[model samples]
Target: MLRTVATRTRVGAVRVVQRRNASNVAVQNIESRWSTLSTAEQNTIAKQLEEAQKGDWKSLSLDEKKAAYYIAFGAHGPRAPITKPGHASKVVAGVAGVLAASSALFYAIRLGGQEKPHTISKEWEEATNEYLKSQNSNPISGISSEGYKGTGYVVSK
Candidate 1:
């Protein structure tokens, strides 16, 4: 008997709290004033919505339906844009700046680097082929081969 009384008291307390938190705002103009509502007001409206949805769905007002849809899919929370205006242009400019800087650095290194090796010259490569032929290197299919008409390491212009 004591447990039943305690349970009834808790249920009555919960109902009183729910009633206190329920908003008096009419659902008809909720769409227009939703953004201006305070957080507490919004939570009250949400509670009202929960109670309304627990009953007959066909009895809900059109305004309530629209409010529910907007609350679920509105661009005010996670769906909101994180970037400011002109974000794409800013990103493109950043990428271009990085590309230009890298190109400049590459050209600076190339221009200040050591000269090409002497072995890269056509004359040096031809002399190397002759030396290899004299050394009988790969006699079957290389510099010392018979009728080997292929260019042998002479690639410089």
Candidate 2:
């Protein structure tokens, strides 16, 4: 019974090792796919991502983001092969048109939603600016500006 138990433990360890090895292989496959991209292609995609980030891509809808990602990813890929009677090119063109339309729609909607933006009140902005200015100019002397208005006080003798 002891020998049988030992054998079972060894088999279990071997199975664990095999699963780990399989996972490693799968990771390597993905790594190879990423590595297959040329440096120039990666640089282009990186630039696209940078531009998208700077252009407020966070406001994009899910479908718009996906479309942009695909367009950026496919920028350096081989052109789709021409099909009989230009059908393939037409289909590709149709997809591109759809993407273009969606992009325009999303862009308009994003811009439209920004017309009446809620902004900080004048009072709050003035207070914030005064606080920042005081912090910058005087470390020890706080409260550069008085909280209350009115310049002076008078009293009867």
Candidate 3:
């Protein structure tokens, strides 16, 4: 009988404490009407709430964490902006205007004046071939004399 009475008393005390905590006027009042508070008061309340939430969050299980994450970060609407035909036409016109302006600018700056078509003259080709032939004839430096040219080829019996 003593043990039963003690358990009931403890349960009653816990319920009373819970009711007292739940009856916080500030939390209730802020939920219904928040704009009346001054900036400093709002900041103070925010900090207190944040600290309390930090401790409460640590006790959450994995499923609770995932639920919170999905509620906060999951997308719940259309991924792309809905565009009517008129809006889409306007967008296309804007893009076409940009492209036309860019093409005009490129032609004005790069291809406005042309003096004869570009061509590799015979003299220029001959000069380039001469330079390449000279480079090819020059033996590579840093190779030992024994390792030069035909030294690595095996002689067949």
Pull out the clashing pairs in model 1.
Answer: none
lDDT of 1 by residue, 18-68 (tens): 553443234556766777889887887887877777767786667777777
Cα error, residue 122 of model 2, in Å, equals 9.7
TM-score for all predictions?
A: 0.54, 0.22, 0.31
Top candidate, metric TM-score: 1
The positional error of residue 100 in candidate 1, measured at the CA in angstroms, is 2.1
Assess candidate 1 and give its TM-score to the true structure: 0.54
Clashes of each: 0, 0, 0
Q: lDDT of each structure? A: 0.78, 0.53, 0.53
Clashing pairs in 3: none
* Model 3 poorest 10 in a row by lDDT: 148-157
lDDT string for model 2 (47-68, tens) is: 5444444545654445435434
Residue 87, candidate 1: Cα error in Å is 1.1
The alpha-carbon deviation from the true structure for residue 4 of candidate 1, after best TM-score superposition, in angstroms, is: 27
Q: Which stretches of candidate 1 lie over 4 Å from their true place?
A: 1-39, 56-58, 126-154
**Rank order (by TM-score, best first):** 1, 3, 2
Per-residue error (Å), model 3, residue 84:
3.8
Q: 1-157 in candidate 3: lDDT tens per residue?
A: 9999999999987874564354233454353344556777656555544443465566444543443343244332243236655997898899999999999999897876777443345555555545644555434532223245542222222
Task: Give the number of colliding residue pairs in candidate 1.
Answer: 0
